[model samples]
Target: MLAHVTVTGRVQGVGFRYSAQQQAAQHNLTGWVQNKADGSVELKVEGPEQKVDRFLEEMKAGFTQFIKVKQIDVDRFNKDEGYKQFSIK
Candidate 1:
């Protein structure tokens, strides 16, 4: 399964991408996480349903500068999301 998550708030420049990469790697997820020009973090992760869900949780509640996570837009997608090994872009 695949999921695309857009996390908004003070998520950029606070090791969010690296943190996400670590979490994704732990789950053996393949995808990418990027910093949007608007300051949100965009992530596309493909893996087991449970692990992906956990990734989403970590994105929202994990140690991200200890700032409030304002919004998270999650989209379930088919298998062709196009990615390999979590990355930051």
Candidate 2:
């Protein structure tokens, strides 16, 4: 499955992308995380459903101190981007 996640709050310049990369690697997920122009963090992840869910949970729970995660918008990704590994983009 593929998901596009937009995380809002104090998510930039707080190691959120790096933490997300680590979590994605741990879950064997392939995708990319990037800071948006609007001060949000955007993530595109593709992997097993359970792994993807776990990765998201880990990111939210582990970075609570640095990130508030005010809002999270998750959507289905239809394109076949074929990401090989998780990355900070």
Candidate 3:
């Protein structure tokens, strides 16, 4: 499974990207996280269905203490880009 996630509200310059990378690694997910110019964080994650769901759940539940996730928009699909590892861009 693959998911594109857009997170908003106090997401930039607060170690969100790095935290996300670490979490993704913990879930054994592959993709990347980046800070958008509009102050939102964008990420793509691909892996098993259960792991992806758990990752998203953790994200929505404030996986990192520094991040305050006010909103999350996710688009799920099956297209595989074959990401080898999680990264912060």
Could you say which candidate leads in TM-score?
Answer: 3
Clashing pairs in 3: none
lDDT values for all models? 0.83, 0.84, 0.91
In order of appearance, the predictions have TM-scores of 0.88, 0.88, 0.95
lDDT of 3 by residue, 1-89 (tens): 99999999888878888888889999999999999989999999999989999999989876778879999999999877899999988
Candidate 2 residue-wise lDDT, 25-66, digit = tens: 888899999999999999999998888887777766746487
Clashing pairs in 1: none
Ranking by TM-score: 3, 2, 1
- lDDT of model 3 at position 89: 88
- lDDT score of model 1? 0.83
Q: Which regions of candidate 1 deviate over 4 angstroms? A: 65-67, 80-82
Candidate 2 local Cα displacement, residue 56, angstroms: 1.5
- TM-score: which is higher, 1 or 3? 3
Candidate 1 local Cα displacement, residue 52, angstroms: 0.2
